[model samples]
Target: MMSQKLAASCHCGSVKFTVELSEGGFDTIRRCNCSFCRMRGAVVVSAPLTGITVLEGQERLTEYRFNTQQAVHFFCSVCGIYTFHQRRSNPEQYGVNVACIEGISPFDFASVDVTDGVHHPSDGSSGGVVGRLLYRPVEKDK
Candidate 1:
């Protein structure tokens, strides 16, 4: 309410996160009907990737990506909390869980345009990712 920083955690509180957000962007929930989302019951309220910051316990998290690993899903490895993910559709956008963050409720659900993830896997052309070897010298680290 008074504080702008939204604190969030897994159901067991093994993992915690904070979002430094602008005044109007906070919401109750966001979601899509894609097979993965439907199964997980995830609602994503997205922001610029730079907006959210993992305050502590980066090592306690796990990543998951399907079809393409570009959209990295970061969750609490201990408690299995679905915190956030890199948007495969818009890799530049940070897909955050609306329920994960503390404070804020659902924005206007009627205006929240849902995407048909069932048809389209992602917005990227081919989920192209460059290898580090392309940039690094051809030598393994000692």
Candidate 2:
């Protein structure tokens, strides 16, 4: 799989960054069912920790953590939009929000696998996909 570099920013454009996606690239996109994730509801793609660089507005970013506090979520303080997160499942990788990436949207995928974050693998449970989110577009009559 080839890696791709993408530009990303918060809704308000207060935070800007560049991300070099992991080898799996868009294939790594997924949704988590954790408390925070369920509320934020952002589709994410994987990138190595070193693959992301803050291009601007680093001071406008804020960190959020909860539960085990292993995963560090980053968002723009101005727009309050989640930009990326250090994955608890894989500390070496960050989950970059697809919505924040240029030319990408969560609706682009027809079906996205939802990870069972409620029963996290780090908690000694077999964390597998519990369900999938499907996007169906209605066609307009001519």
Candidate 3:
């Protein structure tokens, strides 16, 4: 599929970035059922590290690290939006927050695959192989 470029930004527009989508669209969005991800409840799409360019508010971005610390999450200090993160499973790619991307909505996906991140192999804990398939249908106006 042809790659497509999309612009993303924090809730307050403090941090802005552009990402190139290899899948061309939201066809590859996913969710991780890990402690951090589960709590944030974000849908993410992956892109090569080079595919992302920080256009603004670099200094205002804050990082969060834990556990293996391989996966570094970046959020806007102002609006506290989780814009993107370095993937733990694949450090070569970044997981861009789908909600931050312009002109796209999480409700656009018919189903999002939830990875069993709670049982991530790096944690050395036996996280079960179970996965959850989630679907959120948008409610129409009355």
- Point to the candidate with the largest TM-score: 2
lDDT agreement of model 3 with the native: 0.85
lDDT of 2 at 118: 96
The lDDT leader among the candidates is 2
lDDT of 1 by residue, 8-115 (tens): 776567777776543346442346666677787666676666667677777888888887567788889887878888777778767777767675433324344455
Q: Rank order by lDDT, top first?
A: 2, 3, 1
Alpha carbon lDDT of residue 72, candidate 2? 96
Give per-model TM-scores: 0.69, 0.97, 0.86
Give the 10-residue window scoring lowest on summed lDDT in candidate 2: 1-10
lDDT of 2: 0.93
Which residue pairs overlap in candidate 2's backbone?
A: none
Each candidate: RMSD: 16.6, 1.1, 2.6
lDDT of 3 by residue, 1-142 (tens): 5466788899999999999865545666889888999899899988888888999999999999988889999999999999999888878888999999998777777778787798786667665446656566768999
Taken over the whole model, the C-alpha lDDT of each candidate is: 0.64, 0.93, 0.85
Candidate 3 weakest lDDT stretch, 10 residues: 125-134
Report the error of model 3 at residue 111, Å: 0.4
| Window of ten residues with lowest summed lDDT in model 1 | 127-136
The TM-score between candidate 3 and the true structure equals 0.86
